[model samples]
Target: MDIQKDQILETRVRLELDAKDLRNYAKKATGYSFALEDIAEHLESTVELLKSIEKLKSQEEQDQYQIGQQVVYVDEFMPDTVEIITSIVDGWVSFNNGSRGCIAVMIRPANQDEIKANKRLMVA
Candidate 1:
């Protein structure tokens, strides 16, 4: 995501620079100006908005899980199964149920009802 954002920012910067060059040339030739300056301003605002959105998304993801937190593991075989988070590395979440041991799977933070239901299960 960061790499993609960096590439977009670079492209926007290049476009803004190109727009400025065109504005200068147009002014000299036609004795009038293009709306390139407004376009550049809009480009900058767009970049800022993108950055803000990415930051919010990152923060929301970080707030979603933590080490030792209980979560719901959802997959084809085991939908809404409860598991406990063991670790998170590079956006990969690792979790375990008592029997399965540590395994990485698609997970979401378990809700109160799910947690209560999970607690009612017995080993027998």
Candidate 2:
């Protein structure tokens, strides 16, 4: 079954953290079988597979945006804010304010109207 990329990323992060903890426990536990270490290795390998499955933004999507392009960012706590794309890291859109997340989900290319409105606000 298909899992969302964000979900996969979150699960991979949690699994990696758990695997680190398991390795630490294995190191501290005396007279224990290698089972814990083996399990940790399995979890780590699973994380690798998850990394492979997690989808990055497509080349087409990347080409549609540029470092100086403007975008409208929206999150649960705030209204749409016009921001510049400062960078794109591994297909994730980064904004001038140092905020970044899933593009088109929380951010999108700002239309001409929005950009013009923001420019007017800045001039006011």
Candidate 3:
């Protein structure tokens, strides 16, 4: 069987099972018992994270900038930087330096067009 197809079928079967049934199936399959509550909690957290991502996607479709919004900037040679919007004046935006007693850094706001042209800038 194709590995990707097998994974899809396995995921479908797992999604159909209830919390109790999933715990029993896990025990029988792996010989290790897992708490139903723990499984349910994990599933809930995963769903919540998905919902959050969806919300962020919709917000990104609308506008990337809002006062006090948090966004992540992707960097090619370094780790992604997370910054909070501190102020916006004209077409420029200022982000908190993420350091104690540091001044905010100002940069021109990148609109959707700019983001489409340059993939490095992103809004989380």
lDDT of each: 0.59, 0.72, 0.47
Model 2 stretches with alpha carbons more than 4 Å out: 55-89, 92-102, 105-124
Kindly indicate the candidate among 1 and 2 with the higher TM-score.
2
The TM-score measured for candidate 2 stands at 0.49
The numbered model that scores best in TM-score is: 2
Tens digits of per-residue lDDT, candidate 1, 1-124, equal 3444446557656765766676576567552444655665675677566667655555555567888887765554455467777766544566653334333335556777778887313221
Tens-digit lDDT string for candidate 2 (23-91)? 999998887738889999999999998877764424445667888888775554535667788887666
Off by over 4 Å in 1: 1-34, 75-81, 89-91, 96-106, 111-124
Error (Å) of candidate 2 at residue 87 is 11
Please give the ranking of all candidate structures by lDDT, highest first, separated by commas. Answer: 2, 1, 3
Q: List pairs with backbone clashes in candidate 1.
A: none
lDDT of 1 at 35: 61
Candidate 2 backbone clash number: 0
lDDT by residue for model 3 (25-99), tens: 666764344465577557655555555554454444335467665544433453234455676443344566433
The residue pairs found clashing in candidate 2 are none
